[model samples]
Target: MTNPKISLILSAYNEEKFIKKAIESVINQTLKDIEIIIVNDGSTDDTLNIINSYGNSDSRIKVINQENIGLGASRNKGMKIASGEYITFLDGDDWFATDAFEISYKEAKSKNTDITMYQMINYDDESGRVYENDWFNLNNLDESFDNIVFSPEKTKNFLFDLSVSSCQKIYRNSFLKSINASFPEGIYFEDMPFFFHVYLKAKRISIIRKHLYYRRKHDASITHVVDANYLDTVEAGCELMRRFIDNGFYEDYKFDLIAYKINGPRMALMDIREDAKKPLFKLIKEDYEKIKKTKYYQDYLDNLGPKKKKFFLDILKYDNYTEFKKNNPEY
Candidate 1:
């Protein structure tokens, strides 16, 4: 009945296939003083039934069912009701290493930090192979982000680049609540903005280099499937950049970071259907125009070097890149 030390929030939507394994991973955690709150986001499949079975068996498991809200909204809902000192997220389709909670909890407590981030093992569902060793390790910097400044001169450089996935991190509930930080509702790239906001605000953060979170790469996941929702995520990234500019942090460093963020979604847009391409391109063009007006525009253009600069120039010459792709065939 007492508040738990950690809360594992799972935002599920039609994830019946992997819910059991995800739950079992938490149940088998080496750390025991934890509660698992499963937010069943109006899953039409057996996801809720599977979660109910676990709730019946384990006193630590709790379930909340609501109409279909996106992942961000579900997480926000869970955070509002979470009764733990520390919190972490687990997607329904992904499973955690058995010691994830044990390792992160102890490290956060010992270090007395606002956040503790662990590395991840990305699993390829098709080949049944492990692609990489550790995904979140950056080359330079300490485990904590206590002294990272957001000013133009300081922000332009890669002070920190390894904050990748949301599930790979454990956060102090008090810090999260103090910043009034929750995943932004109704967005596709929910993790990036949320992670950026938290990392920028953190007085202290810890990074565990060992790979503990297992991310299952499936075709059905939003990251794999391209859609209008995905374009919305790209727009959200632009919005974040605009926020940085509004706060007087726009510089060559910040612009490069925004460009880097935009680049992934742009590549993903290539794999989307032909019909979705035009509107997405228009949105990207609008974002690009906004970037061009910033003081860092020339620096961003110069820093793009040869390859990306050529691509951007080509897109500008053609009005859009899809037309060029159509003409070139080999592109």
Candidate 2:
């Protein structure tokens, strides 16, 4: 049998409410040469049954039933069995635009790139409002060319900018296999590190300035939940930073690395659980202190704007973020 043009891997864990719509989106894609690989990570709800219902109707729908192994492992499992020339990810709770695969695949082929990055629509479940993901707005670089290949330095900056989400991007199957890029199993925030590895190894990357995916946000989503699991961000950040230094890209990418470290804790302080906040903040603070001693971070701080410098000062001042916020309400 001939391989499909694109393989869409959907990782689900009790996402029964949105699984049907997610499946239908792939099945109805404008590009018919696609396969939908749904990994039911031991869903206790009717998610598996829903997947079965669709698998029966569409020959392209492949379902894998396995024990609850979390998103990272489930995605790895799907990738191992994928038979498509290009690969992409879609959360079971989210769906894609009908022409998503068609457009991305065409761009990847025409550009002969190892990866193709695109924008997404962030849909708020409660508010019923849709907005473009901020990553696109923040990237001031021009992307009007038919094929603008990212330079090596730009690739490092892209990874550091936290534009490392696995979704809303299409990757060449050969490039992924060659690099052996896979997510960290049994961990939260797995995309960041994997994204760094992929972009660093990729020789050619293309960007599209259009929204082709929908990222649904709600209270139940992992991103919105406030818990100890959020500490995984610190763990991932530290590990990736050390790896960057060890790999000898630290000298060139240190500015970005330091910026990432500083911004991470600032964002974490905003949403982490009240009880776990202080401990996580301490860890982030200690890591920052160590990173700041490096020449790269010191240089970055030398040129930092007054507003940002003040922000960093406040963040590093108190170990207890709760008390800090109370004392300085502006933060």
Give a tens-digit lDDT track for model 1, residues 132-242. Answer: 642354324443433332221232256335554679889899899998887767878888767766766677776676778888988888877777666785666765665
State how far residue 326 of model 2 sits from its true place (Å).
10
Candidate whose lDDT is highest: 2
Per-model TM-score, in order, reads 0.83, 0.84
Please list the C-alpha lDDT of all candidates, in the order they appear.
0.75, 0.80
| Segments in model 1 whose C-alpha atoms lie over 4 Å from true places | 137-156, 226-229, 246-252, 271-273, 289-331
lDDT of 1: 0.75
Candidate 2 residue-wise lDDT, 1-331, digit = tens: 8899999999999998988888988999999998889999999999999999999999998999999999999999999988999999999899889999999999999989898988888889999999874674336345543358764556443556546679968999988998787888888888887787777778888888778888889888988887778877777777677667765766777666756755665577667777887777677667667756876566657745665566566656766667667766643
Model 1: lDDT of residue 250: 50
- By summed lDDT, the worst window of 10 consecutive residues in model 1 runs over 147-156
lDDT of 2: 0.80
The TM-score between candidate 1 and the true structure equals 0.83
